[model samples]
Target: MNTKLKAMVVDDHPIHQTIIKQYLANKGVNATTFGNVTEALRSLQGNTYNIIFCDLQMPGKDGIDMMLLLNKHGYSGSVVFVSAMDDTIISSLTCMCRPFTFNVIGKLAKPYFEDDIDKLIACVCDKHQSKASFQKQIEVDEREFLVALAEGRVKNYYQPIVDTKSGVLVGYEALARWMHPIYGLLLPYVFLPIVEKCGLSPELFDTVFSNAIQDIKLHGIKHSISLNVAQDNLEDALFSDRFLARCSENNIDPKTFTIEITERESYSSNVNLYKNLLKLRLNGVSVSIDDFGTGSSSLEKLSQLPFNELKIDRSFIQGITTEQKDKNIVRSICGLAKSLNISIVAEGVEDEETFSLLEEYGINLAQGYFIDKPMPLEAITVLNKEKKYV
Candidate 1:
């Protein structure tokens, strides 16, 4: 059995092309070499190659154009560009021309290491052999602007919140789960921080909101959707307007939605953050100080702003069954929320003891892996059908 992948090499340099062709041929690959784009395009029309290698700094038609031409021709294989420029610039070019072509696997700088090329080819061949590959196949108009585009991929998962008093379903927090082509299902902890760091929090938040609204419409359940909005994102005037506009576009009522602002972030003694929270309240969206009691300024700032809800951080709810200090903290938080007419939700209530204790403290809502683990949107649909509302 001959298992060989055909590879096409396109470069103006005779020596580099020869080296690549020889290397690929020696490695049991069917190697074809072309000195220009015309020959490469002609060969592509006549033959099928698993991958193509192109020189970025070509004379008439550059490597980027060749990649775009391959994309325009609907070639499904990967393209690898060789260049003397930095990989970052090539990556940017790839993003720019991604909509036009799918062949550029990556860019390789000049002064090539034979060993590195061998490794790269090996990785490409392995992907071709793998049954489960993470290569994205979607074609967008402007791939360079895809990160800002609204039509990427979306996945919605439900994290249930229960009534601690009766283990009844009160609502579920809609969590936006991204099934990235390269990265598998990512938790909020993994990508949320990175998104925030990259100054893309507003786009990320919009993606989350779009998915949440879709889920609510799909489930047809009157349950509330609690979403986290970064303080910085909320502070942006455009963000506030766009968010409200998106809600209007999706026909989601503000009454059934809650925006969670981290207590640690909102209570920084900065007046601007508080002002944004007040704007959220004025918009009729419930503003909850999330992870309450996790910060030193939480209790002091509770009275300073109009927070409609308080979420007791999981740290307080965890190990409460065994520790009196935990119980005391929960009691104090509940007392504070009640005194302020703020709805209290104890997050991370995993055990029966914690649940019962929370109900004793008059905590109205609870969520954790104890009552029910995070579930898919379909599972929530089934659960909603079975739930008997009081």
Candidate 2:
């Protein structure tokens, strides 16, 4: 059995290439090294690689220059940058590769040690190994999604959010869980587009939302609850009406529920979206803009819309403890949210250090694995009763 994963390293410097090859070798991967992208391109004619370490500065044909040609050559393997460049700039370049169909995994800044490169190699290997397991995506048709929705196979799990200063459980975010009997839980990324394409987002939303609030009411759960609002449902003229009716039916206050907008495109020219959002606001339901700093028009959206809460995305939160740039951005966002009188919630709060920093910065609410993972309603109801979360 030939179990070789073809790998390549493209660096202008011979020493850098040697170090990377050694790292790959440590992972039991014998990598072919190229002094420049030109040679790498020439080799691509005869052989395909499973992973490539590319450098941005290589005389004439740099990594950016290789993007189009690589795609033209149908190179679909994962690529990581081994360049003497700032990680931020490298990240932007990686995004640029998506347009050209490049499978960029990540980057190793200048002076990266063996551990850095080894991590990338391990990622490619693990991804290849796990594609047939948990990472496996089963495509269920629109009809099956409808059947699942009708059969109540779509479940709701709530992740607890806490008040940063008081350490009191303030709310829970209702994450939709569609459990397939054989494959188990299908993440939203796997199942949602199909639901949207099948024009069944509204139905799915109602199923999840109705179940969540009904559970909350039955258990006398006092914490506020958040629902990730899909644009399709938000655009419906009857959205706010139906949402409010459901709350009323459950004898739950609209003020206890929040609708979160996650997508950058949620800030659209669509009038119905705005109208429904306004109606929700008028009824005392809060609206939060999730992943606040990710989009180009985030500030403009803040000025143009009615948002009661701003959620700082996890990308910024993850590094606040170690990265000064992350701290600076988090501080600025907190200040801006304060000035606008909008409460700020920090998502992806995974440690005590980050949570303390967020509290010091006056973040109102925080949630992540540090606090708790999303769990079934029965589990959270027990916590609510015992006040264990506080």
Instruction: Quote each prediction's TM-score.
Output: 0.58, 0.84
The stretch of ten residues in a row with the least summed lDDT in candidate 2 is 128-137
The residue-by-residue lDDT of candidate 2 on 71-153, one tens digit each, is: 88888788887787776676577657866655777778878688887677777887667653565547677777788888998
Clashing pairs in 2: none
> Residue 270 deviation, candidate 2, in Å?
5.5
Q: Give the CA lDDT, 0 to 100, for residue 43 in model 1.
A: 87
Per-residue lDDT tens digits of candidate 1, residues 180-285? 5555565666555556556767777777787777777776857888887877876665655666777788788776678887877644555566666666678887
Cα deviation of 359, candidate 2, in Å? 3.2
Regions of candidate 1 where Cα sits further than 4 Å from its true position: 1-151, 266-275, 387-390
* Top-lDDT candidate index: 2
RMSD to the true structure for each prediction, in A, is: 16.0, 3.6
Off by over 4 Å in 2: 1-6, 27-29, 41-50, 68-77, 98-105, 118-129, 132-137, 269-275, 319-328, 350-356, 378-390
Count of backbone clashes for each model?
A: 4, 0
